[model samples]
Target: MTKVNVYVTLRESVVDPQGIAAKDALHKLGFDEVGNVRIGRLIELELSGTQAEIEERVKKMCEVLLVNKVIEDYSFEIGEVAGK
Candidate 1:
């Protein structure tokens, strides 16, 4: 099995309501040092395939369903499973 770590974030120009809310909440909690907190998602997928194949498939998956290309950006890391 291979593990793919997909990280998805909003484009810098896009406004993130969730991120803003969280930052505001943090500030209310006395965390004034936190600034411009941008929210993102981490998607982990496990599959069996060669590294190249896995990367190709995951990239397609990102383009099709895992990311919103118009407002978001993404990056991924692929690696072998620890015990597989």
Candidate 2:
């Protein structure tokens, strides 16, 4: 079995409205030192498969449905849990 960790976020060139909002809120809360905030999604998936299989599956998921490559960026890692 393997555990996969996936992350999706807007590319640096893309504008993030929610991030802007958070930055503003931080300023209002007296955290003027906060410059920018970026938003992203993290997904954890457990699968009964080898590490290579998990990588392939997550790669396909990222390319086909989880993310839009043109405007966003995504990365994932696969790992085994201890002795399992």
Candidate 3:
């Protein structure tokens, strides 16, 4: 089985209100070093396939369902599952 880690994040040009709020709260809590906080999501998927096939499928999945192409950008890493 192959393990895929997908990361989805807002484009740099997009405003992140949740990140802003979290940063402000952190500052109020005295974490003064915090700066330019941005929030994102991670999705882990496990599937059985050759590397090339998995890559193609993952790219299609991202474009068709996983990622928002307009406001967000994504990246993925493929690796072997442990003890598999």
Per-residue CA lDDT of model 3 for 1-84, tens digit only, reads: 889999999999999999999999999999999999999999999988889999999999999999999999999999776457
* Model 3 clashing residue pairs (backbone): none
TM-score of 1: 0.93
Query: Candidate 1: worst 10 consecutive residues by lDDT?
Result: 75-84
For TM-score, candidate 2 versus 3, the one ahead is 3
- The superposed Cα distance between candidate 1 and the true structure at residue 39, in angstroms, equals 0.8
| Model 2 alpha-carbon miss at residue 30, Å | 1.0
Q: Give the whole-model CA lDDT for all candidates, comma-separated.
A: 0.93, 0.85, 0.93
Give candidate 2 regions above 4 Å deviation: 82-84
Residue 63 of model 1: what lDDT? 100
Q: Point out where model 3 deviates above 4 Å.
A: 82-84
Count the clashes in each prediction.
0, 0, 0
Off by over 4 Å in 1: none
Tens digits of per-residue lDDT for model 1, 1-84? 888899999999999999999999999999999988999999999988888899899999999999999999999999667566
